[model samples]
Target: MGKHRAYKFRLYPNKEQEMLINKTIGSSRFVFNYFLSLWKEEYKKTGKGLTYNKCATMIPALKKSNEYSWLKEVDSIALQSSVKNLEDSFNRFFKKQNKAPRFKSKKNPNQSYTTKNVSNSIQIQGNRIKLPKLKMAKFANSRDINGSILRATISRKASGKYFVSLLVEEHIQELDKSNNSVGIDLGIKDFAILDDGTVYNNNRYTTKMAKQLAREQRKLSRRYEQAKKDGKKLEDAKNYQKQKIKVARLHEKVANQREDFLNKVSTIIVKNHDVICIEDLNTKGMLRNHNLAKSISDVSWSMFVDKLQYKADWYGKQIVKIDRWYPSSQICSSCGVNSGKKTLDIRNWTCECGVEHDRDINASKNIKNEGLRQIQSYDKIG
Candidate 1:
């Protein structure tokens, strides 16, 4: 079966193209929020929400209406996509899969709109891609995209930069298995610990840029106040906007650095190991501890795990997740004796079986052993 993949490229649109793209994005957001409001009002009045078809059917009349006539400036399909997204949101909310839909905010740092590929409206040709309304725009074209294009999503980042991600259907060949297996333990001090005793240091990208970010943010705050005092709209405040972009760039840099690190680490591990075992961590639950919340967010354990799992799937590798409550650290890997419990401060310990262990490495070993045992047990049952 073919796998779906997305290829994102840095986009460089001209001034006019950017204006049109922004208009399209704003129109989509307006459509989504407008329908969301109608849905809420209907539900409140009669205990029933607006259906997708109902909302979609109303769009033509909406565009013809004098107040929202500007909606016709953007592609009609993008507007319909917004309605579809709203319907999906409602379905998920009723199914208890996600929170209720909310209005889209214009002040959000990231702006995006998804557009379909009808009649090959989207095509990559020689470092440029043709898009609806925006027409042909230049992109980085760094990698060769080998797939039938499904849709394209154009997004603007907080750093005042634009990007386009192409979703495509492709047949991906699975990698040959090496029969190698390993276990990993995740932590704050160290990003990852493998059973082989390899330690990946927690490169705190946010911490590294903390001082610079704070400095720029302070400048932005002052400019914001100046704009307010002058009775100027924040969007029209040139000085304030400039400062805002600077602060945003710092944040963008930190994010890019973190993503790069995660990608490199995940790729290396996936390539080297066939069967990867790790704890099934309840990361959201773990974040409840205020003392560790900030640190955990910076570590981005969930993002790292997601990257690992997806890559493993792409390479035909297996990822075994042990129960979150499993006493990986408490049990001594050497003698299989439970030491009961250990504090976070206790990084090294001596087990009763004459074994001195590095806590993370020991836990990783236990995870590997437990994962292998579970596999064997499952095989026996099968």
Candidate 2:
């Protein structure tokens, strides 16, 4: 009944610990890139690549050298994890699931390194967390974590904030059964419409802050252009770097706001319903229409679906994703008559059976009935 989960906490490290964390993150990135280059070179020459164990064993000799002796200053387990990650990347490439591994750059705003919990190297007590090399850094213990620690990934963000996400194995108790079921129709105007006529409006955070974001981005662009005209490396341009952080802060605010909204909505729906049904929307394909792409992206349908699925799993609820091609909107929920496709402008229509229907509400009802039918075909609970 136990599953692996990750809980992320904001970290407040002292100056010395912060320096060490940065060094560790850099070292891990370097290790991954170094091994990736070696593997690609070897494959080019002999049509073979180095295994993870081979790369891991070579770390000791690397740390002994003067050039890479700094790697020894950070946590060793993090280096091993780096090699392991490279192995996974190669595996995925060979499996045709991903592209070849690429080199990591320090210019990247986000950086992280994973380290395993060996012999109790990681621990949590009070509002402080014990990490390897950086021991006992204070963190925002907003929620209690009750589980056995497996590993921790420390990351630094563009806003110059550090965080740690701990992977833990634990049993999550299922929520009490609400005995309620509902279907959801996701749309651009209203984020979600339930079968029961409950509608959740799409609060477009991007449009709300569009003007401010454009202003800050203009500042960042000016700084970059000035640095380029002055013949200075963009990374070394103090003004540009400072402006980048300001722009990133604005983006961070929008992202946090969107995430908070999605989390609250998904949680509320899952906690109140036992069987949730939805269409398996082709959000990627929907983005191809330039006219509606901005609206679709602002709604963030995919992220909302992902949240619903996971929260449903945690709460022992069911999520039934109906076929994308199902003519939920075309079919009348009352008469079950397939009235041919209607254009987007036709928001309300009267069916041949003389039943008037709202586009989204009717589709949601059909989705719910279809989901129940499918569940019944398999002799499962609705």
RMSD of each: 1.4, 2.1
Best by lDDT: 2
lDDT against true structure, model 1: 0.93
The TM-scores of all predictions, comma-separated, are: 0.97, 0.94
Per-residue alpha-carbon lDDT of candidate 1 for residues 1-382, written as tens digits (9 for 90 to 100): 7788889899999999999889999999999999999999999999999999999999999999999999999988889999999999999999999999999999999999999999999999999999988889999999998888999899999889999999998888888888889989999999999999999999998988889988898899999899999999999999998998888888989888999999999999998999999999999998999999988999999999999998988879989999999999999998999989899999999999999999999999999999999899999999
Task: Give the poorly placed runs of model 2, Cα more than 4 Å off.
Answer: 45-48, 380-382
Query: Against the true structure, whose TM-score is highest?
Result: 1
Q: How far is candidate 1 from the true structure (C-alpha RMSD, Å)?
A: 1.4
**Pairs clashing in candidate 1?**
none
Tell me the tens digit of each residue's lDDT in model 2 across 243-268: 88888888888889998999999999
